[model samples]
Target: MDEVLIVVGPDVVADAGLIEEIAGREFAALGVRGSVTHARDAAHAAELLRDGAVVIPGRSGEMRELIGRAAGAVVWVDVERVDGVEPGEGATHLHGRGLGGIAWGIRHAAHRMRHPGRRRIPYGPHRDQWGDLYTPADSAPVVALIHGGYWRSIWAADLMEALCADLLARGLAVWNLEYRRPDLHGWEATTADVAAGLAALGDAGKVAVVGHSAGAQLAFQAAADGARVTLAVSLAGVLDLVEGDRRWLSSGAVAAALGRRVPRGAQASHGRSPHADDETVRLYIAASPLLRLPLGVRQLVVQGSADDLDLVDFGRRYTQAARQAGDEVTYLEMPGDHFDVITPATPIWQATAEAIAGALA
Candidate 1:
């Protein structure tokens, strides 16, 4: 009985087929069925409202009116617009545009960095719970680089080897941290591994924690949860897990990682959640740095304009929230993509080094 009614505007009717195809794949991935219906006018959209969940790509006069009237409807916006519906209107937003080609370019560049000497140290019994120590000549300032792949098993700390080498070249010791992923291990297990890994670093005084994507969440949590970290660098971090889930970033990777146990359903499809009793919800809230503010340390959020939309918003909102909560925070928005912060060849990486240097000072 559940169906998705995608309403396309008159201007974009020509490309309705392509849009529908993409929408279908996305919906099917989430185990939901969606049907595309091009509406000639606002009246036609209203007539199709009762069909099922309605999807309106971007802002439209008709869609806006429908949003005001049908509060119970599961509305989705393909791309967020300035005149979009209010947050309280119960709608889900999607980040349809991305720089996949640019990201690939940066990934190849990241893979080309000169290999540096690294000492592997075990943090826990599991092979995934280990740290790669890239040391300078003397007892230099330490920077912990945490890699991100939406807390999934596919991404590991190996991808950050080049970045670690770059930091070592800059006369800073780098700790490329690896922890269990939520997909492979349970969320609690993964979070516990991150905490344990930080604890295993021993008395590494006042080190800076640099996290990218999913790692950003862990980095923030490590700092707030009593890691020996002085400064926290969130490089295009997914700081807001709740918002990340609603926006369906990384093709519902957040939802996939969270699994179906929590049953986010339509409640979480909007920005906030109604179910606080769910174990997954509890764990997410406990781990979310955005919800638990005032980390009590200097923080730098490095964001890229050309990065994934979810990451961009996460950086902006997290920086503002930290500052508002009386924590010293700096936000650096540069012209780059998601992987630029980790690619040594990019200017974003240089900026990140500068931020770490300042944090060390």
Candidate 2:
């Protein structure tokens, strides 16, 4: 039996009743004997903290302290939009998302409890420079999942939860990576983190790297930089940075990621200009997968027909470019959306899983 503590803050926006209902449902679905307690304040939360207890702390001034007190895994939730806030050490952070965020936190905690073999390992000192590692009983191929959120700080590695669980079930070691986003840590840091994380997996058999959207760019970049990958999978990825910047895709997300536009009131620690410069162009060339052709590794480029038309174009063109560069490439374009490719139950994901297994075999 596992026990969970849901600590409510005085100013949280999430509905208490709904949160409780979702927590109960998640515990039941996992078939775990679980007891849940809703702690009313910081004092109550402190009292409930115990070894092996999963804690969910709602938005509050003392939320950080509460998370620090928890002896087991912690899932911290904040409904308000926040940027540049890191998750507590060994805790999963969900910010700017609504009640669904709370639900996800509860579900993640329950899932971790249900599968005790999974572990969180940190490769760097920064809070985001960590990964969730899941291993089967026997030796298996390795697959590293990098999530995408347009290189923004608000989004975290939770996006790849479904794929991580699915791959683990099929006897593959899964590394769900979390890295510093360009918006907060600088573009160079983001790239360096991915490379370092992959390098830490030394001697792992036949590693495959999978990235979605912005993550695709990182995966391709890592592969191009010689990250010991046997195969690279890009799911509805943003492959062309220069063209994406020209089209103002995602309202200039590319430029923002390249440090062309810093958020108001945030220091531009990377020393990038507000306008495009020669250095900016160089950055784009260095990061764009389309530009870094001849990755020299087997590549699976998967795109959904119903996703952003720009992404469809990028996938088609990038696949062609990679093939022309003499790299082994398999392009899979199907009917789905940007997210369907990552959802484990979707046909898109099933095809992706098959492709990955084949490539590793």
The numbered model that scores best in lDDT is 2
What is candidate 1's local distance difference test score?
Answer: 0.69
Q: Which residue window of length 10 is worst by lDDT in model 2? A: 262-271
* Model 2 CA lDDT for position 123: 97
TM-score for each prediction? 0.65, 0.84
Deviating ranges (above 4 Å) for candidate 1: 1-116, 260-278
Q: Candidate 1, TM-score vs. the true structure?
A: 0.65
| Residue 321 accuracy (lDDT) in model 2 | 82
lDDT of 1 by residue, 229-249 (tens): 889889889888777777787
Clashes of 1: 0
Residue 120's C-alpha lDDT in candidate 2? 83
Candidate 2 residue lDDT tens string, 1-361: 5665556665555567886787677666656555656677778777766543445565566755665542556676666665555454456667776666665666566666666777888999987898889998889999999999999877778888878888988889999999999888899999999999998898998999999999999999999888999999999999987677777899999988997632333221123424334565556657889877888999999999999999999999999888988999999999999989998878989999988987887
